[model samples]
Target: MKAAVVGLGVEGIKATKALLDYGWKVYATDLQTEIDLEELKISISDAKISTYDEKINISTNNLTIDLGYLDECEIDSSDAIVISPSLCNTKIAKKALSSGKLLSDILDKHKEIFTIGITGTNGKTTTSLILKEILENAGKKILIGGNAGGGFEGYYDLILKAEKGNYDIIIIEVCDMTLEFCDYAFNFDLVGLTNIGNDHIDVHGSIENYKNSLLNFSKNKTTFIDKNQIYLKEFKESNQINELVEYDESNYDLKLFGKFNRLNAGLATAIAKVLDVEDFIIKNTLGNFEPVEGRLKEFKLNDSKIYIGKTDNSDAVKSILNEKYFYATFIGTPRSNEEHRFEILDTVASHNPEIIVLFPGLEDTVEFGLYRLKSIGYEGRIEIANNLDEIISLLAEYSHEDAIFIGGNGQKNIIEIQDRLELLTKNCN
Candidate 1:
């Protein structure tokens, strides 16, 4: 059999290795030139396969397969096309999808395996992590595969690995884009829909489609949802055959802030209860489960409390402001993400939080963000920091025993900024 794996990032590489293990003629390509092809070649050459593909030349080694840059690479006649979620609408993707079925479609044989699918605009990652902890605490071997902040692995990786049939439970974080490409490919034993709000409007167009995407994917599955969520009323209107388990707010010793986190934990608890996991084990796991980094993490430096969060949409930014009281906040609105800067300022202004615009990697984005803030008639104390170092210096001056909020369309490596702020609170004081 032959397969074409597009986008050789983390997941693409995994898919390539998994395909080679199954002794398939794999064609893996990525437009990204920075990927280490030589290192990947060495890794693929060393893997030993226990489950063999029923094909001729099963003994043929790595030389038969190619994993490199996509220089006019096309999916001519592959058995299946496993694509990254981001490339779903691309012209190449349309051609590939027409040529063959999705790799996820081939993976439906593992539907009998115990699986949990969690999806929402936000909190999907945290909820998935908590569910993994609970299952692992109950002596389950968990295989996590999905986009946390971003989609790492494609369906190719999951489908190839699912053929092994080794894992006790498959816990995946599903997004609308993932479902948008491969519809009804996965049949989850349990599904959790974390609270959804105004997010991914650029992809799904309107608020209603985004909500419907969540409901459409839950067909023929036992889904767990928060009864308190606004979407629940609408989901009930469909009269879907899927079992809906409504979870309520319950508190445990979570090392995170915001009511949304407690809601995420509650969703996990609902799944745990359905799986017959003990309450003591669930509480122990919750108490020990660390917060997904960069999503509401607090760092202490002497008398100052520095809270850092990443909000990609206006609603997320608004939620962070509504969660807790922040005396001063350093906001960085990326030019590409969340165009509603005026609404963001509206949320921040309501809390009366001293706003300091921090420098995103691109200075142009910060400038545009400031332009929008000023245009909104937001007459308040708006300060500026040229870079991370300057932001720390400003934080030191403003660290008069005040609660700090640093949020915006920040990237994943935001723990570094938190550490830098911590150092400032130590030395600058």
Candidate 2:
């Protein structure tokens, strides 16, 4: 009657507590011996879950749960082993499955909690938030969780909360990385793939493998996929999934930028429809849906407007570009994704924006991205800003006639940029 929680990372911490609540003699597995087990045991759960790491000499009486991952460890003897999505590839994961199934494989244990899972390279956060509102408007007791899906807590913590609260439904933001750790287990009532974009090459080996992993994640589940997504047909042809619904984008009055976001909304709407959300409620949600900050978040000034999308990848930048307005775009980067940076700069080059303001980023790739823009034969003015404040000043001055855009991978610094734009709008008023 004992269970072990593997990998004491974000997901591991929550899983330990959840096992304890499930009335199993619980033990938390950690790699660090110096971690304080007493501080982690709060009074709310009303259970004693001990900690263990065999590598370091740490004293603990709860040998059944703690110190389970060490050599000569008896983790495989446990009745059930719940794992974090991040641990799918580690040596510890290999050991956990040496005798048992994955954490995701046993999700059916919670039969009362219907689940909806969403996956994509972009728009995961935005779509999840919108779905939350739509379900809330329908008066359903909804809960949300996943890797950065919305909650600051880990996926395991959120799952524990949903179970403890007895929610009617749970919406999870699934990722190839997260699902890969668990053999892509779990068949939900509803699933979604927003769009397969150009990223995550290193993890999945290639785009083809990445798509395959996503298809595997949706195996035997009714998936609502974007009609315009480049990989939909490829994904459909590869898998024998018969219940695929192609969500065609409607001309909804969405508040987010680009036709792609409208398409993202379309995917969410299809799921909401299946959930029996009324049409009027869906329309109301979209009309009032504010974009997630730094993901096509809008800013305004007197007679001028700017949209900020946080990334230098072509998929992110190209979505915000409008052909009608003379574009004054601020772009630069850390070359973190060097291949994608070149592709984004190439896309920006073709648009022939009115003015290109190079915002300073703290990466060596920043210089190389700018060089790529110059080598692309951009004939317009490309001004360099030593600081973000300079870029804001430049954007304010040129926004009178041209539609301004700020694109980069520097999301951490965007708050200052947004603050500056808001200040300008206030001053204009």
Candidate 3:
């Protein structure tokens, strides 16, 4: 067997190691220059695979590497192509798909393993994490993977673990981009659709296309969807889903805020029920589960409360605003379309926070977001922070006696700010 691995990022590196373990001839290519590849090789050589006793020594006998343009790689000569999630939409990926050589084809090899796939425009990470917690609480050995955030191992890593028979269940957070290419290759035991919203429009080309990609992926699988997602009903009538389980917010006592989170918990609970997790375990796990790091993670300093996470869409913004009173709100430059950014700005403006802080993001996006906020009749105080230090200073000054919401496209930036604020508070004490 032979495989061509694309983009030697985290996923690609894992895929290469796994292929080598399977005794396959692997040809890996990345756009990074030879110098970068050498650096990556050095890192890989130094790193130890926690799953195994040996270090990741890439055997050179059947391994080939190429650097520079992806077009120059001899991908056509390989029997299969394993592409990094970042480059799933590239021309090379399309060529691989047309030739039926996606790395996802290996999914069929793990039919004995029970796989649960969770996907949505939002809340998928929460749902996947929630399910993982519940299952673990019930003493189920499971491997959680995919885009579950917080630097969790991805699908390829899960594959290697699954092959080792170390887990009984696999929970994969299937993002839209992965679904675009994986398609029906994911033969999951059960799948959960948290809810579809207007997201990844740039990647999928349209909301309809994005929804279709998810729907198609769920075809012939026992899928669980939110009962309130009425839009799915029309598609369900046409799609040949094995069994569609409609779940509603059972209103489990949850620490996580917002109705959206309740819906996420509901979907996770419903899936847990199917897996025979006890009701007490599910309830207990959810009640103690804190918000995912980049999903409305709460922080308290002195008397003020701060909530930080990704709030890129109007609905997500509205959900947070409706759940609690925020005296101030911080928004980063929107990464979506101009119309969507305006919608988010308009939604935030309508809430009328005491102050709206526009932190740094893409230079072009920051300028347009300011224009949109002002155009939306936002007369409240608008502060612009040039960097994280400025943002920390602003937070220290304003977040003394009230609640504030920090949301934007820059999740990493938000996390960094949170870390800095925590460190500052710790030093003060």
lDDT scores in order: 0.69, 0.68, 0.75
**Clash pairs for candidate 1:** none
Model 3 score (lDDT): 0.75
Highest lDDT model number: 3
In candidate 3, what are the lDDT values of residues 139-232, reduced to their tens digit? Answer: 9997887852334656775665676676778888887678854444455878899877765566678778777777778777898988878566
lDDT (10s digit) by residue, model 1, range 251-361:
888887778888889999999999999999999999998867667687765566878867666677777778777778777656555464335555676677655554663
Error of 3 at 153 (Å): 3.3
- What C-alpha lDDT, on a 0 to 100 scale, does residue 238 get in candidate 2? 57
Q: Could you arrange the candidates by lDDT from highest to lowest?
A: 3, 1, 2
Look at candidate 1 and tell me the lDDT of residue 24: 75
Runs of candidate 1 exceeding 4 Å displacement: 7-74, 77-79, 87-101, 106-109, 148-155, 337-343, 361-364, 421-429
RMSD of every prediction: 6.6, 5.7, 6.1
In the predicted model 2, the residue pairs found to clash are: 27-65, 52-67
In model 3, state the lDDT of residue 414: 71
